[model samples]
Target: MMKRYYQDEEDIGLFQRMQQDDSQAFEEIYYRYFLKLSNTAFKRLQDRAATEEIIQEFFVNLWLKRHRLPELKNPESYLQTLLRNSVIDWFRSQTRQDGFAAERMAQPDYQIANATEQQILYADLQRAYESTVGQLPDKCRQVYTLHQRGYSVNDIAEQLQIAPKTVESHLLKAHTTLRHLLKDYSAVTITLASLLMG
Candidate 1:
């Protein structure tokens, strides 16, 4: 699906274009990371079919949330985090299936610990996100909140009784302000800036 060479473009440039709904940028990201994400997933699950599903679902979700791409300062790490979450989700779902009991028992203790750590990190990130959003200007925060709740730009505009352009302006401002604040935030909390946007 990649139409042209975007080899010269940096990750940040690609992310910006993807946020604007550029299919080429999305394709570039997919091709660039697909193999790496696949390998990462295979390593954790060790099941060919499950690994493929995880990678496929990750790319689908990535495209669906392209509008939030600009918030990712570290695409590589963020992608890995996404895959890790997917793998954990797969494991959780499999746990409820009788066929997966033996496989779950074969999994290493370290893998279990890793999943626990991920859950803790996500909880902390959610709290930090709420706190950071609280610091935003009122209208900007409301627009961002509604946007995250799946409202389209026009929907947000009509609901807030503001012009669509004003709604867009508020979204852009919120992204910028949140990015700046997250950059200066603690390291453990910093990755949340990129991860929690979606």
Candidate 2:
């Protein structure tokens, strides 16, 4: 029988090279891992378009942070864990948002009245934050939004099939870029600016 190479061994070597900032190695890693990770995520999400988007975002992030990848005992296992967690998290967030909306809808007229200018300003700030986030490179924006929505760096990395260090790097770069872009604004504005500009 011809010797069959274990997938994990190939992954480890590619990951190590990616950590060294080798683009060729990272490309090899992406081709090798993207479909597998996407299929795994899709099994849980059951939304092919969303799952594919998520997987593409993940790989883009991996490329962006290839230099700081951490050593992994088993890349496939780690990715599987990430997909499971992300699916759970996505559902939880949907549940929370639904509950919040329901609660708002159930309020009495007196209790549900709209706010004044201050409240409007706050809302505007929130919108501005979202806008800033929209301005980020697609992958960076996705990572930032995921982080804000409570995904951990590890989870984000796994969902994206990249390294934890790469996640941090995207966040850091996003923050720095946002800070520079919104430095002149007030604290609230700055906060909004960073996220939107990210």
Candidate 3:
């Protein structure tokens, strides 16, 4: 199951399989988006059965039309938007009779978790970031610290009495090294990746 599931990670591979009506590939996508979409729908509908039915139907329709779908730059995002639209349609259909859709729509969207989870995530990110940075070579760490402190390349070079090219070199090397160290941490990955030259 793990080996089969891995085959669908790449968008191109998944797209190819769906073209041939591969159910395993379809199942992989179904499970990937199921929780997120179900949560989104339940946020609005507040009905577990209705949410499940809507998402189930959406996936059913998706499988039927998979082969003819056009190129998708981001399949996950596309599916998410589709799920949101499906929820909205559910709301509209219910509204014709209930007329209470607007109030429901005004409620907060589905949050993955509460404030405590957010704090824990932030702390984990900070630890991962600091630990990765702490593992850098002396010069690379120096350059990165200064860069984060708002130092320009030329300013960092001058302050450290190093060549501007050397400063850039250290930053690039640090970026690559930290990326490897922090690959499993999305927040850290984004923070480190954002250090590229403007």
Which one wins on TM-score? Answer: 1
In order, the Cα lDDT scores of the candidates are 0.68, 0.60, 0.65
**Cα RMSD (Å) per model?**
12.5, 16.5, 13.9
Alpha-carbon lDDT of model 3: 0.65
lDDT by residue for model 3 (1-198), tens: 123453215555676677687766765665445544655665566565576578667877777788778788878678878888898898778667654655654456524343345556545655666797898899999998897665778899999999987987786676666546434432322322232221
Query: Model 1 Cα displacement at 81 (Å)?
Result: 0.5
Two-way lDDT contest, 1 vs 3, winner: 1
1-198 per-residue lDDT for model 1 (tens digits): 113456446567787888887767766676556545665676576565576567766777787788765587877788888888899999999768775666765689857875676556545545666787898899999998897665778899999999987987786677556555444322422232244343
Point out the higher-scoring one by lDDT: 2 or 3: 3
C-alpha TM-scores of all predictions: 0.49, 0.42, 0.46
Q: What TM-score, to 2 decimals, does candidate 1 have?
A: 0.49
Q: Rank order by lDDT, top first?
A: 1, 3, 2
Off by over 4 Å in 1: 1-3, 98-198
User: How many clashes in each candidate?
Assistant: 0, 6, 0
Q: Candidate 1 — what's its lDDT? A: 0.68
Clash pairs, candidate 2, are: 58-160, 132-196, 132-197, 133-195, 133-196, 136-198
